[model samples]
Target chain A: MNAMTMIELGIAIIILIGTIVGFLSAIGFLRLPDVYNRAHALSKSATLGVLCVLVGTFLVFLFVEGYFSIKLFLGIFFVFLTSPVSSHVICRAAYRSHVSLAEISVRDDLKEAIIENNKETEDM
Target chain B: MAIQVLANLLIGLLWVFFQDDWSVLTFFSGYLFGLLVIFILRRFLPTKFYLFNLHAMIKLLFLFIVEIVVSSFVVIGIIIRPKMNIKPGIFSMETTLKGDIEVTLLALLITLTPGSVVVEISQDNKIFYIHTMDIPDLSNSVLQSKDRFENAIKKVTR
Candidate 1:
């Protein structure tokens, strides 16, 4: 009985942490200055949050129920692998599509590099 | 990698037999146990296809998780504040890693961390264009990121 309660408590704490992370990610998504910043929030926090939730779910199924889920483990691994890739793709696409940077952005190092490369090419 | 997978699967099957429970957890535990066994015996294993150092890979994973938690808190702190005092910028950094997989994994690690996203890769793949949320000191930030993430990745992948 005590062991079961301890397991339940552990599950609850894990789920709670996951929920808090998801909440923070949502807040970041709504409050950040631009798409890039929002993308950061969405990618990092949401991915971690989802991972935590999945971990909690995994524990629940393992401890509360007597079944183990290969699918859940696969889902967790897949999400961990793919979420960052998707975010990188989106950010690159946004940059190529000429999405404007936030007003406080102080540097465009890529622009300068591109200009230098172009100049060198012309010299050739 | 194929050999590693096969060995792990065999270990997992053995674990299930021992546990007397044909469940995923038992199998997974067995797989992990197999990995540990392999890690221990890596020095003696006469395989030419050892792709990575197991200890370094584990360290990298631990570092990544720690960075995620810390950065998440930092971002959260910034978001909940009344004034959004951010200085975002795109910066280029030179990388010593050359392989496609290494570069891609490095980029993914950077993107997944807080306050930075990989914007582009140079034609020669020698440089990475990264967009960072805060750049109080450009050189410092670059060096910190390189030390923290890039170095570990290089150890694991290269």
Candidate 2:
């Protein structure tokens, strides 16, 4: 195959990998027994998958027009920075409101912490 | 000190190459100005004697890049999917890293990686509360989260 075709193949592989990971993450969202467990699957794996796709796009851009690759990197940087924080906030909210977990859950440090924190607040 | 001056001179020359303008006086003044800034900063904030080992920093940067790309697709997929397809909730990740800066960097990495965002850091800072967009296997996700990102931070920062 030619060089361009090789690049295309690489990009396609990346996109495919990303797509599959995304699908799995979504499935994890549905299949996981509880919010905490689901969060585990969705955030970490999906992040990995999306990054693969972005790298593919970056590669394509680098080959075709080299101008915007840095900007693309910056965009990727912001996504890396923010996604985890927002997820944390959402989950904390759920826990504070007393969301139920799956039956198999053995330990819950967050619940404990929340309880301890509440007691401290009440004492104060 | 002399090495830093030489390095700055080389950087200034490289800049001139990019700009395609070779003005000796301008380069000299720019170099002086850059040195002045560094000097002022150093005066205010004393330089550490610790050697600048970049191996960890480079590794962290590489891992973070990979994470950003992956999480972007994940988030986008969640947005576009037909179903209200997300199992959103908080989970705490156990960590091995102990340094405050290291933990903060790990937290930053977690947040930057998309679908997951940091919520609360325990007072001890050994545990991180994170929210995820979906779920499949919590244990695997927890392991992967540490292996891929948090563990990498520990290796680098420590």
Candidate 3:
């Protein structure tokens, strides 16, 4: 058996936990009732999962191999930045396209705001 | 802004590559040197040096990490229940944050917190329309979270 250091064990555990988080997010995405709800699972939880995996591996390379992968750091930053923006854009587009909310949704205060904006545009 | 910071980092990373040095200390020293070099040549540069509110930036990052971890577990709890009883809905909240950067950052932070996603920002950029997965109170909860985020952002921008 190969000798394992504490750092290696920690990295392995983190990656494994990330995998589990990603799996749970996938389940949440599929099980959620509407597009808006699924976007939550995808944007935030999955991003967390990916963040954990990338940071864990980055640490392994940084500590064990003594290789500084700046690209890996960029990957983390870009993923954190882009995922939320993409998900936000998708949600905005869906709402603008007149997608109806699920029947169980308690309220949609945005509808009133959108109607008011439309009325202002008509006046202009 | 992109060219300025990216150029500095690229120079530092290049130093690491050329010397076959993977040490972070080496990279940082090189980065500092690049910063000095850039500062010396700032007169010729187009954009001014990037100003950072380091205190507020660190605070925002800390809040983001805490929110991400806590809300993710909360979401998982909602999903794990045998019966997925929820009050998924969209609500609008007005924010004091102005400018593209502050507004965008606030929206990004809100979405990254797991339970809520920003569906839209109004034309004036003062109001945000958000879709929450399991939030029960629309107005009060929004105000609470909004105050937390808005304060962090106000520090950073102004």
Candidate 4:
């Protein structure tokens, strides 16, 4: 009936959902055949999972301290900005370091790009 | 005048409703402060509201909330379970998120979630390196991540 109850429900919902997804990502991380694949599960799912918690917090703050909601909004904005870039950097580093892939991977775009660069250098 | 009052009223209602230490006078004061801040800032900085995309952003927010709740449970489960049950490794992933802001947001999100740590990023900003506490097949998981996570972010931000 009260707003606190609603906020608590929202928070509980978010926590439950986050725990499930995080568990899945962790499972994927452990079970996957190679480092590259494990990276995928960890980065993507986890990023999404945390965002939800932050949002729940944001909503709670919005209801509790409406004036301070803007700050939470900014925090969400920062999360939106940083997660992908770090993931990109990490993935690229793994690629450059020659992390092996599973038998299932067929195409290697970065390798192809490297080959092309070498051939061009030879031609020159 | 009407719009201002409405905005103030809605914001005030939210504040009064959520506060643990409820005080009507304090709530009004806070609301007035917010309004004043917005008024002064608007003059110096013009903001693009992204009004058309607001609805889409809201939808993404909901989806993100779901992900967080699910993942938090995942972390808790890991803690409760034995370390021997864990499978740890690193993986690389491709992404279509072009903007720096978007990529960074994604990385921070990954870090915040349990069992996943974003280790590095590529110079081109197209790939992400991640460490996960558990995975069965790295390549498959990576692909799934791209589909599930990277794509979702692209839809929301772009």
Which candidate comes out best when scored by lDDT?
A: 3
- Using TM-score, rank the candidates from best to worst: 3, 1, 2, 4
Q: Give one digit per residue, the lDDT tens place, for model 4 in A45-75.
A: 7666666777777766766666556566877
The residue-by-residue lDDT of candidate 4 on B67-155, one tens digit each, is: 55555555556544554355555556777778776787566556545455666666688876565656554335445555656655665
Candidate 3 overall lDDT versus native: 0.83
Q: Give the clash count for model 4.
A: 79
Interface RMSD for candidate 2 relative to the native interface: 6.5
Per-residue CA lDDT of model 3 for B24-123, tens digit only, reads 8889988988888778888898866643455777899898888777777777777778888888998878888888888988988888665888998888
lDDT of each: 0.79, 0.65, 0.83, 0.61
lDDT of 1 by residue, A2-38 (tens): 9999999998898899899999889889988778778
Q: Please provide, for model 3 over A1-124, each residue's C-alpha lDDT reduced to its tens digit, 9 standing for 90 to 100.
A: 3445888998999999889889999998888998888888888778889989999999999989999898899999898779889989999899989988888998899999888988999999
Give DockQ for candidates 1 onward, in order. Answer: 0.62, 0.21, 0.66, 0.10
Worst 10 residues of 2 chain B by lDDT: B45-54
Best by DockQ: 3
As for candidate 1, its clashing pairs are: none
Candidate 2 stretches with Cα past 4 Å from truth are A66-68, B1-36, B39-43, B47-54, B63-100, B108-119, B124-158
Clashing pairs in 3: none
Quote model 3's TM-score.
Answer: 0.83
